[model samples]
Structures are given as C-alpha cells and as structure tokens.
Target: MRLALAALVLLLAGPTPSQFAPAQAPAQLRRGLASAEAAIRAAACDAERRFGEGDPDANASRCEGVRGPPGVEVGRTSARLRNPRNAPPGWAKAYLAQTDGKKASEVEPAVFDLGDRVGLLRPIEIRKRCLSCHADRAEVAESTRAWLEAAYPRDQSFGYALGDLRGFWWAEAAK
Candidate 1:
C-alpha cells in the first residue's frame, strides 16, 4: 500500500514531458494563427462598423487607442494602417501584391519572421458597404470626405470598390 501511495504521488508530482511539449509546431502555429486572426477581425470590424468609415474620432480610436489583439498589431498597408510601426512585413507585402480582392479574406494566414519576431498576416478586403466611405472622392459623403481630409492630411485609403483590398490584420507573436 505504501509503494502504491508513493507511485501515485510520483505520478501526480508534475506534468509529463509530452504534456510540457504540447502539440507539434505546425499545429500550434495553425491554432495560434486562427485565434489571432479571429481576434483581429473582431476588433477591426467593431471599429469599422462603429465608425461607419467616416468618424475621425472612431477611426483614430482604433488606430491609436487600440494597439491590437494581445500580441497582434493590426493596421492597413496603405495610409490606412498609417503608422510606420504597423507596416506589414516584407513577405506580407509580396503576398499582398499577389492576393486579389476575392482571395483577400481567403488567403492562407502566412507566417513570417519579421526579424523582431514571428507574425501572421490575415488579409482583409473592403465589402460593398465599406465602399460608401472608402470609395472615390466623388462617391464619399461630403461630411465624411471633410472628416477624412481633416483627420488624415495625407490619406490614401480611398478610391476602393467593393471587394478591393483595404489592408491586412497582422498579429505579431514572440519567436
């Protein structure tokens, strides 16, 4: 009985090596990417919907107030993301160049080592409703246009149609 008791204690002492190791690298990466992507979209969509693509304060809040989902730092590739720090990695630029509007949301979340750390980029696109605010200068509401001009002096996040590439949501994770 003592031996059995000791054995039970030993078994419960700590986690197993396999448990410590956890899932394999690829699986972990996939899971991480999926979670990160979901988080990013949730935040971005909330901001976008709330702002209605016109309110300077709303947009600024998303850009400046919210850094991103935990470790992830999300922004647009153009003046949209706007911050140099939020710039997409080199690989993402290349991948984005090849990604079409239809494929933007569907593109496989790419893993990239941006030297500082590993990150995942999930592409995002402009939906039809988004074009109301993101469309050509002529199409945008006068009030929205004025707000955009006043807020973003060098704004380039315009002239997009439905299904256009607005930008991407990038999540930076520790290496």
Candidate 2:
C-alpha cells in the first residue's frame, strides 16, 4: 500500500528530475533587466525634475539606484531585491553598442528560468534629448556642440528621429 501511495504521489507531481531539470535563468534575467530599466527611467525623470528639459547639466549626473523596494543597491538596480548584482556581461555590451551618443537611454531587464539568473533587457533610446547635445549644426547649441567636439572627437551618436531604438541591454547568466 505504501509503495502504491508513493507511486501515486510521483505521478501527480508530474515530470521527474531526470525528465526536467528546472530552468530559472531566463526569469531571473528578465526581473533584473526590468528593474534596471525602471531605475534608468526614474533617474531620467528625476534629472529632468531637478534640472529642466534640455538642460545639459543632467547629462553628466548619475544617481545611485535601488533595485527592489525601499531602494537597495546591493546588486539590483532598484530599491527592491536584497541581492541584486551587476548586469550580465552581454547585456552591458549590447547597451553600450546602442548608446550611439544619444541624450539618454534605458535598458530593460531579462531573466532565465534555468537557475533564476538575471540579465539585461533591451535599451530604450531617449529620442528628444539628443537634440541638445547631438543635434545638427543649426539645431544644437554652440556651447554644447563645442563641448562634444572637444570631448568626443569622433562622436557619431547624434541625428536621430523620435521613437528610434538606440540601444538594448544584453546579458548571459549561469544556468
């Protein structure tokens, strides 16, 4: 009878360990990427509030972000999770590639189900803000353009229309 009961439990539980090794890597990466994107958006909003629209000062500022609730910065980018870590390597590389010298950009978070690991989502470009620093010669402010030329001699991250995808966050995690 005991053996029968055990067999029944196993049947009800569905797949056995040999059948399916739980995959949590994707989920984790998703969660992390989402949190990071939220942080970037919030930071951009905060900068706008603190300075003003089209204010060059906001470009150089970086706020310490919290990953989960209550704003913890351990590894997560928000004030939520207690154990957030830096974005995966691939995510970072992808994000940088998309930056292209735009005004502001944000990346989404990604997660894998294999090992509950986290990764970075794609980055959303700040279309309007680029005008202030990367606009055409007639549109961009003289001072800002001068600054760009002096600082980034080979800057090619300018002249984009609205609603264009600038960059995306990429990541890979252990499974």
> Which candidate gets the maximum lDDT versus the true structure?
1
lDDT of each: 0.58, 0.43
Give the least accurate 10-residue stretch of model 1, judged by summed lDDT.
15-24
TM-scores for all predictions = 0.57, 0.42
**Model 2 lDDT tens row, 135-172:** 55567788877887787665654565565444433333
* Candidate 1 ranges beyond 4 A from true positions: 1-28, 31-35, 48-69, 79-86, 89-91, 98-108, 114-116
Candidate 2, TM-score vs. the true structure? 0.42
Give the lDDT of residue 91 in candidate 1. 46
Error of 2 at 103 (Å): 15
